[model samples]
Target: MITVLIRLLTLRAENVIPEVIWALMAIYVLAVLVTLTSVWVTFKKLEGRLLWSLIVLLVPFLGVIAHCLYCLTHADVDVLKQFGFFTRKTA
Candidate 1:
């Protein structure tokens, strides 16, 4: 098990495509940035902000998806508006 992990970690330079590697890294950075900003802006309480920040940072893509799902189902419209997510005027 340990040997397999070490082998995976020690990837040869020849085996990787530089463009694809940079693209994936860029996507990850963008995702983390957007998710962290969303978490900070949407949650009013400090603990909520901190907890979601940690979740998104530590868990990667799945954490961003989870936070989005939670917000869609659980967040108030006013809160989302406060975060500048909703811009259309309400009747």
Candidate 2:
């Protein structure tokens, strides 16, 4: 089984096109997964499912940018505040 697997890998490496195509497909799948996860997490945080979904699907890079900005601006304040975090101190 090991030898057979090695032989298959060797053959695949000999053909650069197939390897390249496979790499591209893997990268595309990874990017899609990352984008979907990002959008889902952002939606969960923002509670704006429909609107954010549309924006994420239609605008490339913008979804990620929006998510990052939202996280940066609100994550520490709003989200954390819910869990008794970032409470104000009385003077």
Q: What are the TM-scores, per candidate, against the unseen true structure?
A: 0.63, 0.40
Candidate 2 residue runs with Cα over 4 Å from true position: 1-32, 41-47, 77-91
Candidate-wise lDDT, in order: 0.82, 0.64
Q: Which residue pairs in model 1 clash with each other?
A: none
lDDT of 2 by residue, 23-65 (tens): 6567766765676676676566555766676665677667656
Model 2 Cα shift for residue 39 (angstroms): 4.0
**Decoy 2 TM-score against native:** 0.40
Top lDDT hit: 1
lDDT per residue (tens digit) for residues 9-58 in model 1? 67865535555567668888998899899999899999999999999989
Whole-model lDDT, model 2: 0.64
* Model number with the top TM-score: 1
